[model samples]
Target chain A: MGIGSDMYRQQILDHYKNPRNYGELEDADIEHVGENPMCGDTIKMFVRLDDDEETIEYVSFVGDGCAISQASASMLSNELQGRSLEAVRGMDRDDIIDMLGVELSPMRIKCAVLAEKVAQDGIKIHDGELDVEETTTE
Target chain B: MSQQAETLDVERIREEFPILEREFDGTQLVYLDNAATTQTPEPVVETITDYYRNYNANVHRGIHQLSQEASIAYEEAHDRVAEFIGADGREEVIFTKNTTESMNLVAYAWGLNELGPGDEVVLTEMEHHASLVTWQQIAKRTGAECKYIPITDEGRLDMEAAKELVTDDTEMVSVVHVSNTLGTINPVSELADIAHDHDAYITVDAAQSVPNRPVDVTEIDADFLAFSGHKMAGPTGIGVLYGKQHILEEMEPYLYGGDMILKVTFEDSKWNELPWKYEAGTPIICQGIALAAACDYLDDIGMERIERHEAELAAYAYERLTEEDDVEVYGPPADDRGGLVAFNLEGVHAHDLSSILNDSAVAIRAGDHCTQPLHDVLGTAASARASFYIYNTKDEIDRLVEAVHDARQLFA
Candidate 1:
């Protein structure tokens, strides 16, 4: 409505409008939920791991949240499919930020990264690397 | 409404807030999240510093002069808050952690005991989590049904639905005086009348209302009210819960031990007075004093003037935002709406829009704003909000419009 048409990229809105990999994973080996509380952005992430507990056979998410969070979740599910749990554990904040393809304020950085955090937490729980009680606020 | 009225000396007011002096993103810090929490003024900061520095003794327990001074300051803050909200007496105001805890106190102490099976607790869809979830928990515990009045397309409460929902089974009606997300100023007085007709007490969540407007508990005839100090330029970790004297006396204490007891012998203990009985453990003395200072500051500026100023600004923001072809605004398009705007760009996500605005040093809130039920009703998971306060200016609104235009461009 103002200047460049690049702001509302079709790819971004397309993923948001009709998100792929946007439902619950039945009998998930690991699951975790995180909420922003202030903004009311909630996310529940699910992970199905290989028998050896090294690779993520199937990853999915189901929750009601903002478009940014939903799209990010969709993107993460697609990226993390067939990827090993250890590879995602090695991923840093900068990697997730870069994947979003947009700048994020400190406050909103959480919204964009919330799904990743939950996914990592779920992975950690599955691998027995960390206890399920240890909640990460990433 | 004319814009020719003398503008508030925002520069002078800006100087009073130390946080405003800090630079952000190579620009002057422009904080638009007043609805979340206001920056503390120097006077209030100094009051807190002086209390912790000089009078650092536990109040109501020590006999030293420092303790006496601290106790007096704490009690004076209670009195100030009681007078600020036009309560019947100081005993009516009980200090809690914040508005959430204050409302929880009412729900656990009042709701758990008074409500039972077949009882109904009426609330509106526009309530914050603090107001909504507490009632939900109470309903779960007491087997009482939780009913909500739906919101209209313009984000106003549907009074027709409210009338239908409120019946003889309605035990209590807790509604927000002003919606934080939509900025719709609810008709609490009229709602109170409806609740009273059913012989039910009403509790008003004044978190958004008290900070922006003048609220008289007696005039509204609210049996209980909850608000936070931080929302009104006061310190965090402190809030006030105002309950009718008789109702408070009848309810059980929320917490146990410490100053809340009159006499204890390990067998049977008598609870203290109306306000003190509910306030257990060590109180937030310094924050309470700062809250009193904030009350004085608002009283000096005049709440009516602040409300009128915000109304004008809200109307101006609504008008300008609507001009953008892609912008979809939520809430009632009325001058009487509170000084907040929740909207969404055509294509960009609210978080992305908020992030881009941050790049331009234009602070705004983006999300469900802790009113998930209302957002669900509005058919969106999140929205970007630009809220106005005493320090905000029309020029800032212009900046916001331009920045939103920039955000739209970035995503386009």
Candidate 2:
């Protein structure tokens, strides 16, 4: 289990075992759901904005998926607090991978990035740049 | 040891597959992902290389010597596959790209013309995306209704529900011979009888069955049967669709241009013979010949013995995997299923389990196995599948169980 241990780091497992900010937020200012169609991993992100509306006051997520996906969502939710909506949207694949603290393969990369995509797509929908439909990370 | 294992020279059979001898890091490869595709043995591989080396030419066209040899070998491949599947003659066998193409061929050429708004097409809940999606799109185009035979709690098709579903309005009944995810061996012959009683055409998607067991199209009295070579120790890009001669004669061509024509004028064109009429353009020449070699190889080992070997493996896998707590194995009892096991460990997603198993050099499938609807019915996002073939062994299954235990530990 040498290589497998490396892929599922202690930090990632902690996040997966005890996910932070995990659940639906009541009357969220922003809400979006996305799914990895290939593996059926889903993440629905919810955000409550600050008075400025550009800043994220609270964020939560609810879904079922592999360890990488669930852990990434938990880590991403922890990172969301006190961050600007723009900053959250600016969060890229590298930021999520850095948060997870593990190297992912091509297929695992999708699981790692699903949370980031859900957050970004939610912001886009809130801004009316994209329609409010269920997004998919095919 | 299982009685089937005693009859089969598994040690000798394993030697034919060099890939099985491969080592990942310090661990050996324990490949159990046979449902997706089987690894080709040396003989089939040699057949492929031999074709290109000696007589690599376009089939059924040129007057040259190379074309004659290539054409004869290609036609013989058809005869071999027809005999393997118990088709009447080579005329009943038509080679296409793969099983999906075969399903599309029947859907477009038969369903589109025969179905109308009131017409119904019956299928099972356990169909792979190949047949399910193909028929769904066809139903949309033809304004026909699509009905699915519900599965019982044990993951077998609900035959009681089926009799209620297939009425006079039903025009077609397409079903998978084996469930790719559940590993349930559907009673397609019984389904065929029901379809026939209702005067509906039945097509069997034998992609999972033909590679692992003896499938007789004549005994089933099927209108059409589809299977892929890649899943049967043959090369990719080749598949067979066996249709009764009279039915194939009545249907229009699915593809056009090139060799599938009698003659063509500026105004119109007449079609070619039975199988050729459906396969337009240049067919998979070497792949077809290599597929025949695969059939010959399976025959030499005996398909009944192969079927028995897989069933024994599946039962063993089911029992071993079930011994672990929170490990839910899907499908029927060991004796009732095909050569695979679909399962999940609690709190450990299939991808994670698959990745952990890879650390031990164990390869298994982790996804919906192309049966999204079936997964939905099972109330799972996805599942992990360990499929067996002729070459797999009980020792490899033990390795899989050990890796799964390792995955459970890591997740826990």
Candidate 3:
């Protein structure tokens, strides 16, 4: 009556349980914190970029959140580690959603993608390139 | 206890709520989110419909027959609500948008005047954001200190901590009668006594308690009590703030507008009497009438019986859910608790669990439940909550158990 056992694949649990690269990066050039007050999920993304902002020197995350959010942060931190700041900032919602390796409902999508969005926002804010107005959820 | 429980016809009472008749997917609509808001009954809906169709008019100002009828109906609803909570008089019941607004009214009007630099407003760590944030803003405005009575790991409020925090300098003690997240009902009557002894006022956020249990403002000895109509099977956008008459007379009007003014002068306007002074502009007439109908519905069912029924249901839910190998339930597993269970599955995140449950057409709240501080204390960012009301039944609980087992299998 439900999805197959592959839905709870061991790899997913492993990533969720012992999330990779889950901590703050010291001497980071950019930092952003996003919070879901509805679920009390807090994610902090730290990015340390090299001079000229062409390469990502380091990236790490520290957050108190659900397993999906933590795992998403872990995956995001790993994916952005060697990528350029421009590449990281250019990542869209679908790129991060696909990285999660599981389907997310509309409501849970925000929780899964919050870390990636925060990273992009942090980079934009730090690079003095933030031009868009903040979006308010009803 | 068994004989007393037998007096209430559970099945008959469940028939009153129309939502119980509907089916969700293949299963019956097992609404366990009553603490969030109860399902409105036919009578309450009819009351609103009747008002809008027949006698919908601006209240307190009209001399026409329909307008007078509407005005009377609105005031009568106030009287009904006032009596339901054992308030001193209908004049003490001020209508606001919801419990949040009611709390803000007290915070802005009363607390702003009484609370100042070096003064303290004591609150519990278990309060919802509505109660906690209002006082926090008040503290920020007055340079007053906001102290908290911490809860133990078991979700019980520490009286020793409360005693230490509530002192001569404490001007107000605002606490939730029942925690919406944990479902732990506090001993507010005793707390009110303690607050009064210290010459401090007590305000209770009865948003969770009023619907499930019988609340008497006089018995609790509360200076002010606030609850939302939506939570009690009434329409939304309407709430009641029950203040002691003398205390209400002392506070300034919350908003300046028509119906709240007694004598209008450009320089200064005198405010109207007790409840009307606080109710600025046009009231939620239909919502208030619906709220009165809701009050009548609950009263007819008897609150004590409803409380016992929910306690039994909660106990059943706790025992059944905890029987699973990997589930962790929050709050005390006692008859004293309200009919709410906040829990987590070992391998599944709460949002995932809720989504799966939604797929099965089961409606349960999956989030912080609006008590972030309490969630922090529980050591979880989110939890799946199943809260019960009059419409819920043991069969629904059984279905929930089956669905939960099925949900875990998805994670497995």
The candidate that wins on lDDT is 2
Interface RMSD of 2: 1.8
Per-residue lDDT tens digits for candidate 2, residues B1-412, read: 5765547888899999999999988789999999999999999999999999999999889999999999999999999999999998888999999999999999999998988899999999999999999999999999999999999999999999999999999999999999999998999999999999999999999999999899999999999999999999999999999999999999999889998999999999999987789889999999999999999999999898889889999999999998988899999987788999999999899999998898899999999999998899999979999999988889999999988888888778
Regions more than 4 Å wrong, model 1: A1-138, B1-7
Ranking by DockQ: 2, 3, 1
DockQ of each: 0.20, 0.67, 0.30
Model 2: lDDT of residue A38 = 76
* DockQ computed for model 3 against the true two-chain complex using alpha carbons: 0.30
Candidate 3, residues B1-412, lDDT tens digits: the string is 6785545686776777767777754656677777788888888888888888999999988889999999999989889999999997789999899999999999999988888998999999888999898899889999999988999778889988888888999899999998888888899998998898899999999999999889999999999999999988898899999999999998888898999989998799999887899988998889988899999999988898888888988899988988887999888775668988888988676876776676656778988887887787888878999999887788888877887887777555
Pairs of residues at least 3 apart in sequence or in different chains that clash in candidate 2: none
Q: Score residue B57 of candidate 2 by CA lDDT.
A: 97
Which 10 residues in a row give candidate 1 chain B its minimum summed lDDT? Answer: B1-10
Q: List where candidate 3 sits over 4 angstroms from the true fold.
A: A1-37, A40-64, A70-87, A94-103, A125-138, B1-7
Per-residue lDDT tens digits of candidate 3, residues A1-138? 222222334655566678787776778888878777776667888888778677887888887666567778888888887788778867888997788777666676787788887887887777777643532111
Tell me, by DockQ, which candidate is best: 2
- Tens-digit lDDT string for candidate 2 (A1-138): 445667888898888999999889888999989998778889999999989999999999998889889999999998989899778777788898788778787778999999999899889888999988658473
